[model samples]
Target: MEKITLYYFLVNNKATLGLGENIKLLLEDAALEHEYVRLELDEAWNNKKVQLVKEGLYSGTLPYIEVGGKKFGRTVPIMRYISVKLGNKYHGANDEENQILDSAADIIGDWFESAKLAFNGSNEDKKKYVEVDTPRFLDIFERYLSAQEGPYILGEKISYSDFLIYHRLDDDMALDRLADYPNLTKFVQSFVERPNIKKHLASLSK
Candidate 1:
């Protein structure tokens, strides 16, 4: 946990915003020592300083982490590294748990891509996503959540994947559409009520 610095962009895209905010929220909730350095368009994509020292980093990419004087890339991997730095509270307790963690993370990634198709794809693609694809994913999410014994997938102990799940649901404005999604509704309500997250949610409104 030596001098952790997260470099993220100032973008309007909710997905990007959610990833960066999720990192900050986790760190904030843990009271971890961290700093968020906002990277402008030039610094993120074409900075000479970043280029000169980018060789040893995982992807030499922005939306990355600089910790212990080293860089790590890719969203899920960086979150995993953060968990390790924080004594692995968000990590799985064993191999079986790790399998669940990885599987859940993969599902989150896949769901994002499917949602992206609705956002940026052709009209026909969007139509099918709304009428067919979205309902399908929502059903998948509902079943998985209902099968869990606690609010989170891994029982009461919240994992890193839960943050992404919360964001995807919130970003899609699914927070208000909860007539048939009781488990998901509980997830959203409980997530927003977490102390640090509740404060952040309030700030977003004002």
Candidate 2:
């Protein structure tokens, strides 16, 4: 088998909350052997992107991860791959549980899409997103989280999806409605306070 490879871009505003960054956070927490590579997002990277395509590495999208002859690109699939790769404990117990988590990931993807509008859209659109879309998604996550057994999404178990959820909620200025949802707020705090992840997250800032 060939060596595994993964590549993804950092989020512009909150670098730490990026999909690829979360993967790095997990790898660090697990004490895994990995190297992070980043190129200046300028003409040099533009030329390099073409080279990656020619070399069968670029998928034209990010969170592009491949391991053990398999590749995944997209939110949920990438999380699932990383979850299983990290350890079975970071994944769902059965098919049904996995499916439920996938559903939650779908919601997260949609929620993030709306967030992008706030980041790049006009003033009116941003206002609409803040007043309408924020509560719509937060309410759902709040209810789902409240119904769970404990701090983590899988209740007592830590999953890769939890990291993704943390970033979306942690995105400053965009997802402010999180405070209104007690469960969601508590979940984010728990993730921040986790010993290994907390240390890992602090490292990213420096």
Candidate 3:
């Protein structure tokens, strides 16, 4: 089989990982062979390489993937495609389960989008969102996790949703704010401590 190729920007910052890093983690967890094509964000966009990628997907987007002679853009769809290809249980057990998983992922995506806005919005807007909108979403996640047999989002099996939630919360939210929700805090802790995940994170720092 052909190796999966991921195209993403190389950043100098050690504090954050790009969206492609999540895909790299997924590939590691799935024990799949892959290669990365790291590009300087500015140069890639100005050059023909990124233009070719955009033409392939018909979208001007970064963090693209080429696997099995096909192209995928955007994080969520790429994750779903790879999970299915690797036969990872993360895709869920059936269509209904997959739908449930997709719903959770979409909600998480929305939360992060709102978070970005909150970070850049006016002081009053930020305060309203952090004090009001943020907790509302956190409550939804907490309630869902509390009701489930977790450690994970769905149940006994660790799915992409678990990684999705963990990455966003760990990367985007302040640790102090996470204290109010013990389940979410624990969820992020457990996720980071997983053997493969732990190793992957350590490698990033180096």
Candidate 4:
């Protein structure tokens, strides 16, 4: 029952969730209690709040967290830490299962680099990424899902990787691009419908 604090950037009255958002969604899904400290990126470098975040959390990054007096940075580690604290879900059931889930999660992290290229790179770079790199990554994920007995990733149980994958794909790529990947599309639809996730997402829009 220790307090959990998340320090992240806010833009236009909305928090930038990108990687940090999924952690918020996961905490909500698990019915965990936490607080958020939103910072503005433009002024964060010299701002007192952000400076405290860097010093207190030992991280020069947005999406820093403090829980039980210990600080953490990065998305996956934070998710894993909280999931472990909550117990018996989100993370895999056993060591081998956990490893598989971790691998999947790491793959999603790798995809984010490609997503950046597609989103922020020049026109030709974006086109090449979307037409070439994006589909290849999607195919890998689609194949993984198809191989599973899934309404969630790694089989029927929803793991942290599922949320990570969903956010990255939906937030970064055009949904129409998913037409050829029915299983991936279905996974997104089903994930968003989960009661807590649905509620959390609605709150983000506000």
TM-score per prediction, in order, is 0.85, 0.82, 0.84, 0.87
What does candidate 4's lDDT look like per residue over 1-206, in tens digits?
Answer: 47788877764464643667768777777777789777776753567556666566555675778887877888888888878776757888788888878888888888887777667778998889878887888898898788777777677888888878887786565556888998988898888899998898798688
Superposition-based RMSD of candidate 1 using all C-alpha atoms, in angstroms: 2.6
RMSD of each: 2.6, 3.1, 2.6, 2.4
Model 4, poorest ten-residue lDDT window?
10-19
lDDT, candidates in the order shown:
0.73, 0.69, 0.75, 0.77
Off by over 4 Å in 3: 11-15, 48-50, 53-55
Q: Could you tell me the TM-score of candidate 4?
A: 0.87
| 2 or 4, greater by TM-score | 4
lDDT string for model 2 (77-179, tens) is 6656656655665678988777767777778878888888677989998888878887787788788788786877788777777776776676634445566
| Model 4 alpha-carbon miss at residue 166, Å | 0.7
Give the per-residue lDDT digits (tens) of candidate 1, residues 45-87.
6664467355676456556777776777777888888898778
Whichever of 1 and 4 has more lDDT, that candidate is: 4
**Regions more than 4 Å wrong, model 4:** 11-17, 46-56
Sort all candidates by TM-score, best to worst. Answer: 4, 1, 3, 2
